[model samples]
Target: MFHRSVLVQKVLEFLLTADDGVYVDATIGDGGHTLAILNAAPKATVIGIDSDKSALETTKERLKFFGKRLELVHGDFENLDDIVLGQLGYGSVDGVLFDLGLRSVMVEDRFRGFSFKKPGPLDMRFNTDETLTAYDVVNRYSPEDLERILREYGDVRGARKIVEKIVDARKKTPITTTEQLAEIVVAGLPQRVHTDVLARVFQAIRIEVNREFEKLERGLYAALEILRPGGRLVVISYHSGEDRIVKHFMATESRDCICPPGLPVCRCGHKRQIKILTKKVVRPSQEEIKQNPRARSARLRAAEKL
Candidate 1:
């Protein structure tokens, strides 16, 4: 069920204020927000970048009507600097948006192994070039390693039991498919627990396979660097971990001091770089969430460069 971006109106209202300057949709997943921005600023040029070639291709076809207004680039959000300065030949941008996390298409594609509801390949990589897959982690990771991923990434309550079951199952035969692994984890859990926990486990594997957190850290900072003074940076994250990174980055970027709280003097000389536009993270309205359950977890945060 592909749905429009959670905060389309809000994002467009903020970005469209800039009449003709360049705008970037960092995670241009399915071009949901991209379309909104393009419609809002018809004369403004947009650089839509996505790590998934398939996504860029689909977006290209979906947005074919936009013609020359949209410039679709195939690359990871982490390569924002290279794409912006090296390829586009721009030192600064007017606005940038990141609707982070897995897209609805990714979740819906059982072949991607992002959702536990259906069985598919244990491949969670966004880009096909990546060697690591969910299969590699599930079958090869040590028990402690599996436990760490489950505990840290999944936040699963029965991480120990689940990891033990995984290690035990892999010994008999390599866990080659999503069903094989999901069955192992499901069997390890109590019947009373909902399948949502299992979903988190899958999410953990996907995140590990793609190094999502690291990419987000690098990508957000890159956006900060590429943005022109007074340029707006809008980010929409779907999970707690992703949200925490955005929260911290926005807070610190808008802060003046990095010293300890007790220290009165400014020793670090950290100057504020951004002015936060949304103090409280904006969430999808109830109507939107009802229309698209996936949007339930979405949170939007915006800031302007100093």
Candidate 2:
């Protein structure tokens, strides 16, 4: 499972605050990090939440030995406040860990259409029950809409060229699969940047299909409500967009007055709610990256509730 989860040690180091604390693994993919938390803090209880039911099921099996210490919830983290509050009321969470990376299992599953290397239908919904899918975005979006997500979500170079290829290819026949899209992306990009752009295109479409940015924003704000004083909120995000969201959230929440820069006095009366634990963004060490190359892009930020 991609070296059994990236930066598991870092997660435990930053997130576990108490032996019998109630923690929430907001994206408990395969229970890797959650398992690490349980082992590190023997008396801790974890309410693991994920949108993917299959992932929760896999985690359930892997962590069955922990019994009631593991409470696997089936839902999106965007509802984090309601979910956590329902379990422990207000301000009761000891720690919250948002490991915002795709699982290796999900990426490797050809049927999931997450990997450009895999030939599969463009169905990259984390929850199969969700209405939108990668196919909807690729085959149906206008050239402008396609380019918007490519630039806004993917931040890929040559987005216009990629959109042109997609629009033209879809006119011949609908862009139906991951392989087709990857080929179109490659054909549109310069050879030097082709592979990276191809990956970005898929990632952009997947992010759009899942509304990942929207949910992440909502989840970050809502999570602040459930953290007890001194409780930690640790986020590990792999994408730049995801990292930006976490970074801004932490910065905004940690500030006492959010008035305009030139304001003489504080008008926005926003009391600081959190203390930033990591002054700068924390990243995985070279040793960890050597063990799991995917860990290289992980940006971790932590804060404690005030």
Candidate 3:
């Protein structure tokens, strides 16, 4: 069971605007944060959206007691605007919470291939219907493209070596499983490299397979558009890449002018749309981290619409 909700107390404290308002859990996962919101604000209603059907099913069963107050939707958050407008129309939502950590249910499931510790098929698609999988990327992508993904997404130091090994191995036989890929990555690196090298390699492939970065960018903008003035947007991201995107988006939107530094005039016409609530990024407390180690990497930023 995906039972842990990281920073639950802080999320409720910062995210809820009123006792009764519409809230959207953009990545509801197993409804941990959604359930927290409902518990905090008894009169509030939540629109929970997730790409994985299995996640939605788990969330539904876990939160069934909430009754009609929770509306579970099966879709990617990238289409947040369409989902919100189609279901509830525009500009009325009070808060949107994005808990960006992948749930333990997904990681622990050997079939998902998210963890190198588990032996599984190289299928990391959040939505299983997606055509691209880790298997396809490892076997079909050109050496140049493979190196790029490893370097950009994983921040792997020896990306070229990893790609070279992958290309060489694939020539002999298709690298179809997580274990096989991990072995190749381990063999490519020098003996001094940390074991985490394998994990980084796998993570890069998973990110590309799911298009997480693109979806996150779209979802953040859409969340901003749907929030009414004074409404809140709270995001909790689990990695540096994701935290950087959320941080930059909030900083850019909260600034009045985004024109070139040397420009004498403001030609961009960009207006400050939201006010950043947390001057510094918030992290889970030591106690919280001790309880849930997964929360250690979480960086939370919040802003209110102007």
Better of 1 and 2 by lDDT: 2
Writing each residue's lDDT as its tens digit, candidate 3 over 1-306 gives: 575988888788778999998999999998989988999899999999998899899999999999999999989899898899876674569999998857788889999988888999999989987789999999999999999999888899889988899999999999999899888889835767747798788888988998988889899999987898999999998878888899889989999999989999999999999999999999999999998888888889999999
lDDT of 3: 0.89
Best by TM-score: 3
lDDT of 1 by residue, 63-88 (tens): 99989888999898888988998998
The lDDT of model 2 is 0.88
lDDT ranking from best to worst?
A: 3, 2, 1
Maximum-lDDT candidate: 3
Stretches of candidate 2 above 4 Å error? 1-3, 87-91, 188-190
Model 2 per-residue lDDT tens digits across residues 1-306: 432687787788888889999999999989888889999999999999999998988988889999999998899999999887875464578999998857888999999999998899999999888989999999888889989999999998888987888888999998888888888778734689867887888899999999999999999888888888889999989999999888888889899998979988888889999999999888889988897788889988999999
Clash count, predicted structure 3: 0
Q: Tell me the lDDT of model 2 at 242.
A: 92
**Count of steric clashes across candidates, in order:** 0, 0, 0
Spell out the clash pairs found in candidate 1: none
Candidate 3 runs further than 4 Å off: 88-91, 188-194
